[model samples]
Target: MPFALYLLGLAVFAQGTSEFMLSGLGPEIAAEMGVSLAAAGALTSAFAVGMVVGAPLMAALSLRWSRRGALLGFLGVFLAVHVVGAVTGSFTVLLVSRAVGALANAGFLAVALATATGMVASDAKGRATSALLGGVTLACIVGVPAGAVIGQLWGWRAAFWAVALLSLPAFAGILHSVPKGAAGGPGVRGELAALRSGRLRLTLLWGALVNGATFCTFTYLAPLATEVAGLGTGGVPVVLALFGVGSFVGVAMGGRIADVRPVPLLVGGGVALCAGWVLFALAAGEPAVALVLVLVQGALSFGVGSTLISQALYAAPGAPALAGGFATAAFNVGAALGPWAGGVAIGAGLGFRSPPVVSAGLVAIALVTAGMGRRVWRERVGSVSTGAQDK
Candidate 1:
C-alpha cells in the first residue's frame, strides 16, 4: 500500500469516528438537550440526510479542482464544523453542527475514495480500498466506544473536540503527502446521465436497502443492549465493541468474494442478515444467544457491502466518479430512513428489538427487488442473444 493510502485511512478513521460517535451519545444527548430520546436520535438522521445530499453535490463541486485539493478543502470544512459543535451549548446548534459537519464529511469521503485509488498502483487498488474501509471499521470498533466513554465521563461537547484533534493531522497529511496531478473528471452531468438506466436505479435501491437493514437495528444497539439483552451499563460498551469487531471481520471477508460472485454473495448476505435478525428477535431473552447474533448480524450484513457497491458501479451507465457518489448516497439515504423509522417504531411502543424485525422485513423486500432485477437482466441477455442469432 502507498504511504498516502495510510494517511487517507487515518483521515477516514477520524471522520468515521465523528459520524458514528453519535450512536453512543444518543441517550446522553437526549438528557442534556432536555428533549425526547427520539429527538436526539434525529441527530443521526440529520447527519445521514447531509450525506445523502452532500456526496453528489460535493463530488460535483470538486470537479473544478485537483482531487487532492478537493479532499483537503472538505477536510478543512469538516474540522471547522466540529469547532462550532465543540463550542455550542444549545441543542439546536448541536443538531445544525452535526448536519453541516456531515456535509463536509460526505464530500471528504467522496473525494477520498478517488484519491485513494489514484494514489496507488493498479494492482494495489484493492488493498488501498481495503485499508480505507478498514480504517472506518476500526473506527467503529474503537473510536465510537471510546467516544461514548468520553461522553460518559466528561461531556458530549468534549467528544467533538476529540474529533477535531484527530482531524487536524489528516488535513496536514493530505496537504503535504498527496502529490499533484490528482485531477477530476467530466463532472455531474455525466453522472446524471445514469438516471436513464433502470438497472442502475435498482442497484442504487439495493444499496439503500442494505444500509437500511444494517442501521435499523445497529442504530439502537445501545438501548437494546441494556433494555432487551439485559446487559448492564458497562456491558453496553462491551457489546458495541464486539459489534464493531464483527463489522471489521465482515469488511475483510466481503472483499474476498465481492468480485467473483456478486449476485449470489448479495443474496447470501441478505438471507443471512434476515435470518440473523429474526433469530435475534426470537432469542432476545437469552443473553448469550443475543450477543452472538449481534456480532454475526454485523458480519452477514456488511460482508458483501463492497461487492454490492462494485456491482452498482458496474451497472452504472454514467461517469465513474459519480458511481461511488451514487452508491454512497443510496446507503446514506437508507441510513437516514432506518433510524427515523426505528424511532417511529420505538415511539409506537414496538421496543428496541422491533427495529431488527423491521430490518428483516426491509431485507426481505430488497431480496425481492434483487430477484426482479436479476430476471430482467436474464431477459435482456436472452434478447440480445436472440437478436444476434437472427442477425
Candidate 2:
C-alpha cells in the first residue's frame, strides 16, 4: 500500500476500534450505568440509526470542502463525541454522545472509502476499498478484545477513555496523510439520479440482505456461545476473537476474489454464508461445532463486502460519493434490523441459534436475487451486441 493509504488505514482502524469496542464492554457498561443489558445494547442501535441519517447528510453537505478537509472535520467531530462519552455521568448523556459519535463516523467512513479508492488505479479499486474496510475487520481482532480486557481490568469508563486516547493519533494521522480530491457538492438531484439506477438498487439490496444476515447471527453470538454452545462467560472473548480472525482472513480474500471475478465472488460468498449459517443452526448445541461454525460464518459473510461495493460503483459509474453514501446506508439498515430480528426470535424461545437459521433463509433469497441479476446482465449484453451487429 502507498504511504497515504497506510495512514488512511490507521484512521480506519481507530474508527473501527471506537465503533466495535462497544460490544465488548456492553455488560460492564450496563452494570456501571445501572441499566439492563438490553438498554446498553440500544446504544448500538442508536449508532446504526445515526449512520443511516448521517452518511448522506454529510456527503451532500461536504461538497463544498475537499475530501481531506471533510475527513478531518469528521474526525474532529468523532473525537469530540468520544470525549463527551468518556466524561459523561448520566446514561442518557452517554447514549447521546454515542449517537453523535455514530453520526460523525458515517462521514469518516464515507470520505475514507472515497479517498482510498480514488488513490488507486481503476482495476485496483476493489483492493483499495478492502484495504480500508479491513481496518474495521481488524478492530474485531485487536480493539474489541483489547477493550474487553480493559473493561475487565480497569472499568467500562476506562474503555471509553482508551477509545478517546487512541482516536487522537488517528485524527492527527488523517490531518497529515489524506489528500484532497473532488470538491463539488453532488446536489440532491445528482444523488437521486444515482439512486434511480437499477444496478444501484440491486447493490443496496445485496448489502442490506447480506449484512443483516451477518449481524443477526453476530448480535447474539455471545448468547449462542453460552446457551447453545455450552460455554462460560470466559469463553465469550475467545469466540469473538476467533470470529475476528475469520473476518480478517475473509476481508483479505474478498479483496483478491473481487479482483478476479466480482459477481462470481459474490455468488460464492453467498453460498458459503448460507452453508455456514445452516451449520450454526444445526450444530449450535455442540460446543466444538458452534465455535467452528461461528468462524466460518464470519469468514464467508463479511467477505462479500468487496463484491457489494464493486457492484454499487459499477452500477453508478459517475457518482461515487452518492454510491458510497447509499451503500453505507444499506449496510446500517441491515445492522439496525439484524439484531432486533434476532432478539425477537430469541424472545420467542427459538434460542440464540435461531438467528442463524433465519439469517440463512434470508441469504438463500439473496442467492436467487443474485442469479436473477446475472441473467439480466447477460441478456442486456447480448441485446447490445446484436444491435451493434445489425449496424
Q: 272-309, model 1: which lDDT tens digit per residue?
A: 88888899888876889888988898787777565566
Q: How displaced is residue 294 in candidate 1, in Å?
A: 1.0
The global C-alpha lDDT for each of the candidates, from Candidate 1 onward, is: 0.76, 0.77
Error of 2 at 10 (Å): 2.0
What is the C-alpha lDDT profile of model 2 across 1-391, one tens digit per residue?
6677767777778777877888768988898799999999989878888899988787677656788888888888888888788778799999998888887888777767767777776556667777887888888789877887888899888888887787788777777776545454465576566556665677688788888898888888888888888898888888988888888888888877675577667777788888889888999889888888778778887788655875565555456666777788888888878878888988998877799988998788788887787644333222212221121
Q: What is the C-alpha RMSD of each candidate to the true structure, in Å?
A: 4.7, 3.9
State the weakest 10-residue window (summed lDDT) of model 1: 382-391
TM-score of each: 0.86, 0.90
Mark the regions of model 1 whose C-alpha exceeds 4 Å error after superposition.
Answer: 23-43, 88-94, 118-128, 346-352, 375-391
lDDT of 2: 0.77
Note the residue pairs that clash in candidate 2.
Answer: none
